[model samples]
Target: MAWGITKKITSAVKKSAKGKATTASASALMAQREEARRTLLKAKGTWSQYDGHLVRGRQFLADVVEQKKTAHTDGTHTQADGELVDIDAYSHAFDDTPNRYSASVLELFLVQKGLMENSQGETYRGPYHFNSATAVVTGNPAQSAAVQDMMEVLKNNEGAEGGSRNHASAMTIEDMRKVMAWSYKQCPDELISLIYSRVQSESALDMDNVILAQKHLVIRAFATTGFTIWTRNFELTKIRRKDIVWNCQGCPPYDIPYDLLQDHEYEIYPQQQTPEICMFTHLRAWVNFLEEVLLRRPLEPDEFIFARVGANSVVYASDQLSYDGVMKMLAWMCKEVGLTARYTTHCFRRGGARYRFMFTPLGQRWSLATIRWWGAWAEGESKNHRDALCPIPREGDKSFNGDHILTAPITAAETQELKMSFDHELNCLSGKVEEVLDKLTLAPASSTYSSPLPAPSQPPILVSSPQSLQPTLCHQATISPFLESASTPSMIPSPVPVDSTSSPSPPAFPTTRALPSSSRQHGTTAKKAAPIPGVGIPDLPRGPEAWRTAVKQWEDPAASIGGKALKDWPEEWYTGPMRTITGVKRNIRKVIAMEFYRLQRDEAIFVEAYPEATCGVKPLFDAVQRQREGRSEITRRATYITLSRPAVAGTTFPGPTRALAQLYLFIRRHSVLVH
Candidate 1:
């Protein structure tokens, strides 16, 4: 009878599962009741025979779920390690936001791990899930509100949602906008404004619509720059996959931009282009919602593209950036990053042009004209003055830019070579000047007012070179005073005659920003000054344009003219020394030598002047003097200068004069030691 009852109950359950009313049938209900009675009787003699056990299990499960879902505001529990823990651990699992997993699964796992226990003791739950609460305690109220809004946006855009139950991996811009709008709904307008206004250059942001868009702007700025921040434009933008070509066929009808060529070389510098990697990392994470994920479709030209994250469904796209907008963004970033010194979005543009023109392997040295047309200078309209800011060189300095830079102390050996090269260059210019002056002085006067000198067999002094007469070609539109100085009027000054033997003292120093012409034959242009090779722009005294002409004419011997031409000539015909010694570097070593001399040659003065500087100067001085005289000291007191030694150790030194005395003594002693 019991087995028959169980069969009847099973049939009723199956019918119910199939959405039938089998359990409601009188015969079925009666059979179920009978089955229950038999089960109870069977359980009475088995492990599951405990009364109320089944009821307890259901109640426990319900209570467990309840505890997790309820909010806990206070922290009143302690762990096994006796550390205070927040009560939210059990409660937070119930939070509806950022809920990516099932509470049931979490509860079961916790129970298996012995983290929690059911009231009936049949199941265990893991540690309380409130660890995040401690971290959340420090969160800004504004941030919390913003996060909530973002959560709401996700809910509104279910298609992009990637919750625990939903394992969807793709997202789209429309979905992200939905989530972002929801997340910001509850946030204060001020905080919302802050997030939207600041944008970095790497990514496009709704710049006109947002407040406080600095974060986005900063990221974008970083993106536009080279891959590494410290290296300053060492990398270029990565080519998209579509640009890659596998064909080996030649003769494509159209020419590509210089940058697009695989191995194009600059005419000047011939270094090969280095490969660069893409800077963007995860494409999906950029947008917060899964519904916003892309479907991974191939890109097609002219297809409109929108940012993955925004408040709007439609966004304008552009292959080229709006120059004005980008400049404003760049200025904002420069201020944001505290780099008031070197940030200009346009700087990157100019830098791109310069990097191509100056640094590339097909390295072509750009003419000023080419630089102006690169679109960089058009935006730099206000900085027109910078074109003429030529770097100046010191007298006799042969360095490329005329500037000598020594990061650390240079050795005497290096100095000697530097000095030799510097002097040689100075001498060469000075000699040329003298030679020109002599020729000028010997010429007879031939002004329109004065009678012409007897016709000589030599040619005229001002004859033009064939090369100078040709029209100057420029690749870029050159402007500014420097360019004008080089082209409009010859950069070289007109040469005047003078007496060679009575050459005047050189000028204090010569510095000119005026550029020398690229050619001399075109009288409209001046001769190009020989740049100190290997150096960039530098300042140097300009040579007279007519010097070459004068030299040629002087050699001809028929060009000499006028009485007392040298009388009107300026005194300083030659440029003075390029670099002068700093008083410190010059005086320090000399002082050492002077001190040694005093110690060896004048013991009385050394002892008196540097009484506190030495412990036994008199005796040491005697020894040094004796050593100098090929004799030995009579006293055996050990004496030598050390870091702690008082140069005036024996007495209270007066003002700076005492210091000077010590310096002198030190020099004297040093000189003796060296000898």
Candidate 2:
């Protein structure tokens, strides 16, 4: 029996030794693998580890490397050339380092202050928080003993808290709330209950709460709703309240609520009742009112978050204040209490606009069904389903039709007149009255067909003087000089007449007429005259012989001179893309249509503008071709011009365009003419 027991004990000892050896070997192998992963991560770059495990670190590193390799292979990494890389292996190797923020917290002793609590149910403030023993307390005498003690400590620590120290400012309403909210986690139950009580009472007006609310709205509107408020022209109603409707079947709603609020057209101002204005600007107004009536210490130029009270002024006018004055206020308020990177009011406008689309109903945007139902997407279709749809305002650009100002806060009659004016402006051709009339007669109802019905005609308007219709004629006069200069070279000296009966009086087009005595100096007046045939006045010599003898070859008024009015125009000129068109055919057709129409429009505008030039097509063609080739020279040119142009000056196009147009005409026309 003794011998058998001994044998069993011996066997057990041997097995234990083998198991220990295996465990050591495994641990060593793991350590070596971890080291190797770290090395690889260091090699690949951009590897950072969050969690604290060697294995996890290596895995994260490897993931990063794999991502990097994939990016390289997929042409996403600009620096990487095509190479078969072990993406997974690279990722596993790189994710090993600790986070910088976590390290900063430790270094700054933030966690200690974060965890500290007082018997009065108060907690240690963040880095910005000063103990009664340290701070120089001001403003309210009702501060607690704890706060007093904090101030005392701040006095002793004045060396650390300098006058210019950014973090030394008092806690904002927003920062205090954030700290209290965050404090609840580490706080004892009794302290937490007290904090909640303080919050409930709302007696303590903290900057943190205001900032928190603004941030919450920004997140909700921009990050979640995927829709944003485009225009904030209202003082009373700033909230973007456009919601998407599911089964909405009525006429589209306008943004009139906000518009009216802005214009103060409503009886006694509905900003108080309007929900959109109620959201943002009202808070500012309330704050301003409080500061005036209660606080007595009015807001400074940079103190308020919204444009109310003292905060309302342009940055240039403010002189000393920054453009983002509200942001600075919010930051000062938030950081003092312990929060970071809080938002301001303007953040909502941009943020909301960006994300508003996400919350919109799927078919809210102009689509095939919308086009069919509306006959055309004339900016009103977005309002069709108002309940659940928030339509993003399509802003105006050189390319697309933007928000119609016709829907703004004018009377219905005024709106109608405005609409008529808008239609006339859009419908009219660019030239003399007779030329415009002739063009209108030839123009098709839709540009897609060759011999379509003619566009609607208005009674012939006169071309009296430049200022006859409108006294100033500022808009027209702005472009007149360029046209005049362009036509200079085309000028031909009147043939020296043989007789005196040649020239009639230079067509007595009336001059731009002045307004009545009661009318304001710069005000406009309507004038009427018979339409002249050709725009450019053929400069005739003073003698009657000039007009009679200078080759009066009458041409037919109805002659087709390849003026590119509207024959077989592209379909895209009238409609957006076709919905049912599928696959490559759809893409190709649409691309071709867009390209062709762009080319045609550009060609027509340039050719008509510079008729004397031979290679008029070259500039337009090159510009369009580069666009099609994705070379993007036009954008670069525009961006460059924008960058180079003076900020407080005239239009960008008129300057460079005039120069380039002249250059093109001079080179193409003069060069060919000389040759």
lDDT by residue (1-675, candidate 2, tens digit) is 334545654786799866753355888768855665665445423344323344443444445456677657753333235534444333323333544323332432333334442322334233233348877543334355677799988767765655233232222323323543433332223322232344445544334333343333322222111112232222212221122111222223443222221121111112232233223333333333334322345544334223322322221211322335434544654565455443444433333333333322233333444332222224544433222222333334422322463354656665565566544543341222222112111232333323211232332221232212322211111122323222212231232335576753221113223212331222342343322111111222223232121122112212111112112323432222211111112222223234444446364553354332233322333333345334331122221112111121111112223243223322222222212
Model 1, 347-425: lDDT tens per residue?
Answer: 4444444544565332124456545533334553442322111112121234433335322376675666556655565
Candidate 1 residue-pair clash tally: 92
Clash number by candidate, in order:
92, 72
Q: Model 2 — TM-score against the truth?
A: 0.16
Tell how far residue 396 is off in model 2, in angstroms. Answer: 22
- lDDT of all predictions, in order shown? 0.32, 0.32
Worst 10 residues of 1 by lDDT: 573-582
